[model samples]
Target: MNRLTIAAIAVAVLLVTAASSLFTVQQTQQVLITQFGQPIRVIREPGLHAKIPFIQSVIALDRRLLDFEASGEEVILGDQRRLIVDSFTRYRITDPLLYFQTAGVAENGIRGRLASIVSSALRRVLGNEALLNVLSVDRLRIMNEIRDQVNREAKRFGVDVEDVRIRRADLPEENTQAVLSRMQSERERVAREARAEGAEQGARIRAAADRDRTVLLAEATSNADILRGQGEQEAIAISAAAFEKDPDFFRFWRSMQAYREAFSEGGDSRLLLSPDSEFFRYFRELPTVTP
Candidate 1:
């Protein structure tokens, strides 16, 4: 071969060696240097890193948070109720050496181990709680407990469990309809009690109103009777006073009133009496006047 071609071949080999010996550590990545499947050193800071071309290898790990989700699982609670729980976890690889030893350098292995740890934590913590507590507002506290437990177990795997949360917690499909029916029955019972209480109050108010109306009417009737009796007494006293003032005029007025009342608007009315009867006294003769 020519000298220039040999030099070109030599330069190509050097570039390949340089490329294989150098790897970039990104801001979001941590790397592990492994020799023949044995981790030798861990690189946490971000920058350019180097390893042996063929003997030492670089295993890049994500330094940022990772998400892990557990499959939906049915668990029995302390109350003997069944719940299907789906959970999610957020974690980070804290120690790359321990992570490589425990979970290997692959993402799948890390995820598998973490998911198992989270599931066990969930089962242990939630199994002791009643179903109501699992579904209540205190679920935040339950999640914290699960996180604490997962973190404790995850440290062995060089993982930091930042947060653990239940994605969904629900009854089995077979039990859903029964739970709905019970809730509906409870609501109906409450409605019935409310309606009964309202009707009772309404009836009490109506009865009190009726009693008050009856009492008011009775009092009004009694007052009217007393007024009528007083008016009749006043009329009798006035008539007696007039009669005492002039006996002849009073008798004449009384007889005239009786005659008018007996004949007024009575075209078919007739009465027969003696000539000297008191009822006909005014008609028998006119009184003489002295000058």
Candidate 2:
């Protein structure tokens, strides 16, 4: 070949080599340099970086926080209740070198291991808690405990667990029906008790009212008898006074009142006395007319 053709070929080789040697590290990524399938160093700073053309290779790992979700797991609480718990975790690759050694270069490699760690922590912490604690405000404390435990185990894999949360927690299908039945029975029992108490109160009130009515009627009858006795005594006194003033006239008046009563309309009275009886003295002879 001529010198010009050889020089052109050499320039092309240099350009290809320059392109292979340079790489850009983004703000969200970290680079791991490996030589012949073995790790050498990790680069965390962002911006332009260089490596040997064909001898070394760069594996980029995400430096930002990562999220992982675990499937529903059955856990037994301290109250002996079975619950299906769905949980999620937030983590970060704090030590890239250890992460590369343990989890490999792919981000997906750590998912299985992290999920196992999180589930274990969830069981350990939740096993000591009651169902009420899991569903109440105390759940915050339980989650913190789980996060701390998971974080401790995750550190070995170069992962720092920031938070662990239970997305949902529910009783098993079999337990749900049983719980509902129990609740219904309990409510029925309370209703029955309330009805019994109400009935008892109603009976008591009725009894009190009946007793007061009887007492009031008895008092009224006694008062009426006393007034009648007093009036009869006054009438007797007045009649005695009239008799003293004029015996003949008073006798005639009394006899006339007797006759009217004995022969009053709608009366079925019959007299068996003789015609000359003293009760008929006024009928046989009229009294002298007073002026």
Highest lDDT among the candidates is held by which one? 2
Where is model 1 poorest over a 10-residue stretch in terms of lDDT?
Answer: 278-287
Per-residue CA lDDT of model 2 for 1-291, tens digit only, reads 999999999999999999999999999998989999898998989999899999899998888888999999999898888999999999999988899889887767899899889889988899999999999999999999999999999999998999999999999999999999999999999999999999999999999999999999999999999999999999999989999999988988888889899999999998999989988877788667899
Those runs of model 2 whose alpha carbons end farther than 4 Å from true positions after fitting are 190-291
Worst 10 residues of 2 by lDDT: 279-288
Tens digits of per-residue lDDT for model 1 on 1-291? Answer: 999999999999999999999999999989989999888998888888888998898889898999998999998887888899999999999999998888887789988888888888888888899988988988999999999999999999999999999999999999999999999999999999999999999999999999999999999999999999999999999999999999988988888888888999946778897788878766778778999
Clashes of each: 0, 0
| Prediction 2 global C-alpha lDDT | 0.93
Q: Candidate 1 overall Cα lDDT vs. reference?
A: 0.91
- Please give the CA lDDT of all the candidate structures: 0.91, 0.93
Q: Judging by TM-score against the true structure, name the best candidate.
A: 1
Cα-based TM-score, every candidate:
0.73, 0.66
lDDT (C-alpha) at residue 277 in model 2: 94
